[model samples]
Target: MNINIDIDFGNLWEALSAIGTIGAVIVSLWLARKDGKKKFQVVLKTTIGMRNDNSIDETPYLSIDAVNKSNIPLTIEEVGFINKRDGKKVTVTNQNFLIDGSNRLPTKTESYSLAMFVFNQEQLFKELQKKWPQGKKIRAYVRDSSGKHHFSKHYKI
Candidate 1:
């Protein structure tokens, strides 16, 4: 006895097209998911204010604000100022510099007054007032819970 197998060209073409369409859909979905993860991000802002301690003179202070727009929490490791001209990092060793925030910054929330520095106020004021050397910037070094470091754009003052 002999068995004959029939090959249908039209059916084969239709099956191939279906497989291609399925593959394309899978690839599109994967790309969408990968891009979605990048939507989670953190933003930082800095400003200067005056603080007086029962004195006639007012002292300038630096305030940093951190906003978490991502779905996960972030940890702010260090905060300081950067002299844009010579690219120098400045940090006060005194107790006036305070870091106030949870180790884990929650998602989709703003942390106000996260850090404040009262030291070197006069020097900072002089830098801001001076025309030479351009301007100064605030820098905050942060990391995620997974220990992935994230940097914010330099906020010029």
Candidate 2:
């Protein structure tokens, strides 16, 4: 058997174009994922901190220091902390968050940033010293204007 047929170049071109479009979308998704992963790494590294300075008296009053590295005044939308007491962890937060300043400026501000919990205050530290007389570890975190959080170079409790 012998068969001969003329190919429609217009149809062939359209098929190739569809394939090209699909390939482009796949590439775009891959690039976006890679970028997203890189961003997570940056934030993670800048967030977690080491407990090198273990001074018990280093007042752990939660506060925030905002630096406007971006070319505009960035506003922090939230700040919170997680603390452990009696083998249980608790979270404290302030939703009415705001960091105000101009571009290329750093704002050093502190308000009612302390935890009102009786256990998290300094009085508890004194009690711990009298009872356990051992070091207690509490992790603190601060969220910035961009919602990136960094922990303290840990202190003692």
The models' CA-based lDDT, in order, is 0.46, 0.39
After superposition, the stretches of candidate 2 with alpha carbons farther than 4 Å from their true spots are 1-69, 82-90, 94-134
Best candidate, lDDT = 1
- TM-scores of all predicted structures: 0.41, 0.29
Positional deviation of residue 48's Cα in model 2 after best superposition, in angstroms: 27
Model 1: residues with Cα > 4 Å off, grouped in runs: 1-59, 78-96, 99-138
What are the per-model numbers of colliding residue pairs?
0, 0
lDDT of 2 by residue, 1-157 (tens): 9999987667778999999999999999998776543111011011222244853443332233333333234334333333435543333332222112211212222331221111224543454355443466554444444566544343355
User: Worst 10-residue stretch by lDDT in candidate 2?
Assistant: 38-47
Residue 73, candidate 1: C-alpha displacement in angstroms: 3.3
Q: In candidate 1, which residue pairs clash?
A: none
lDDT of predicted model 2: 0.39
Candidate with the greatest TM-score versus the true structure: 1
